[model samples]
Target: MPSLTLEQANQIIAGALARSKASGFKPMGVAVLDDAGHLKAFAREDGASMFRFEVAQGKAWGAVGMGASSRALMQRAKDNPNFFVSLAATSGGRFLPQTGAVLIKDAAGQVLGAVGASGGTGDEDEAICIAGVESAGLSAG
Candidate 1:
């Protein structure tokens, strides 16, 4: 399986933060999780809240674990709230079915990992994640 390189992870973060800044969003936190749901890289902007890392990582972890974007998971959660709650408990709080994460895919459409962000509205967060993935020359799902 193809792996997410650290350099790519760094580029994602840089791009995410740049997008956030350019868009006048709040200080953001970004997280990248490998295909196995392992945290590959993370960053919390200086003014971001302390909870940013866990929230950002949780969203990314959920995307990698469920093989879907966090936005999709959020929609599913709305249809079956109980199951998603159980998933959070089962994940030991590492999973968050929210709208702030996107699955990362290679040019061939292979899932590479996921990118998530926090410290803004869900849409704003999701936008930066997509930007970061694109900036890294990857696609966002």
Candidate 2:
């Protein structure tokens, strides 16, 4: 199975931050995790809050652990609130079923990992993650 390289993770972070800056969103925190849901790289913009990192990582971790985009998880939560809420405790609070994250896939549709962002609306954060994945020559889902 193909794995995500540190260089690629850095590229994704840079791309996400650039897009966020271009769009005039608030300072952001971006996190990239490996297929195993391990932190690969992270960045918090100058003005972002310290808590942004945890929020960003939680969203990405949720995506990687569940094998789906955080947006999908968000919808699932809407359908099964109790189970989804329980999942947060199950993950020890590292999972966030929100719209600010996306799974990263390779050309073969293999899960490479996930990217997530915080410090903006859910839609804005998700947009940056998608842009980052695309800019890094990966697919976002």
- Top model number, lDDT: 2
Pairs in steric clash, model 2: none
Q: Which window of ten consecutive residues has the lowest lDDT sum in model 2? A: 44-53
- Across residues 16-115, which tens digit of lDDT does each residue of candidate 1 receive? 9999999999999999988988888999998898899999999999998899999999999999999999999987888899899999998999998999
Q: What is the C-alpha lDDT of each candidate?
A: 0.93, 0.95
What is the C-alpha lDDT profile of model 2 across 14-36, one tens digit per residue?
99999999999999999999999
lDDT of 1 at 132: 97
Candidate with the greatest TM-score versus the true structure: 2
TM for every model, in the order presented, reads 0.97, 0.98
Q: Which ranges of candidate 2 are over 4 A from the true structure?
A: none
